[model samples]
Target: MDLNLRNAVITNVTGNTQDQLQDTIVDAIHSGEEKMLPGLGVLFEVIWQNADEQEKQEMLDTLENGLKKQ
Candidate 1:
């Protein structure tokens, strides 16, 4: 995993406006850079930390479904 991606993204995570946050996610996903995954993992960690139990379950279900589609 990219420790640099984690460091770069995590430090600037505070006070992100919605659009900026969306852009970060979108760019990371669409960048076609192999190193984007750790950034996504960081984002997922942020999401996971903030999610409630039901939401977490939903995320897990979604992930499971996506994996099954592979």
Candidate 2:
């Protein structure tokens, strides 16, 4: 994704209050669990940017399980 579009998405999601952010993230995780590809891809991208190698591996493992559940 282009930087501008990525920034727009981050801005939109993070604009919520802390509680709302938590709710939104929870909803997103459930969406990811269902293998909603676009949602999962967006999350994976964000996690990729911020996660360390070990964290990345953990996330990938979670994602693998999530995909299986789907």
Best by lDDT: 1
Q: What's the lDDT for candidate 2?
A: 0.71
Off by over 4 Å in 2: 14-18, 27-43
- lDDT at position 17, candidate 1: 90
Query: What is the C-alpha lDDT profile of model 1 across 1-70, one tens digit per residue?
Result: 5678677878877689989989988998889897877777898998999999999999999999999999
Model 2 pairs whose backbones collide? none
**In candidate 1, which residue pairs get closer than 3 Å at backbone N, Cα or C atoms, i.e. clash?**
none
Provide the lDDT at 66 for model 1.
Answer: 98
Candidate-wise lDDT, in order = 0.87, 0.71
Prediction 1 TM-score vs. true = 0.81
Tens digit of per-residue lDDT, candidate 2, span 1-70 = 5577666657777656879866766787776565445543565588699999999899889989999999
lDDT of 1 at 56: 100
For candidate 2, the 10 contiguous residues with the lowest summed lDDT are 35-44
Give the poorly placed runs of model 1, Cα more than 4 Å off: 1-7
Whole-structure CA lDDT of model 1: 0.87
My TM-score estimates for the predictions, one after another, are 0.81, 0.56
lDDT of 1 at 57: 100
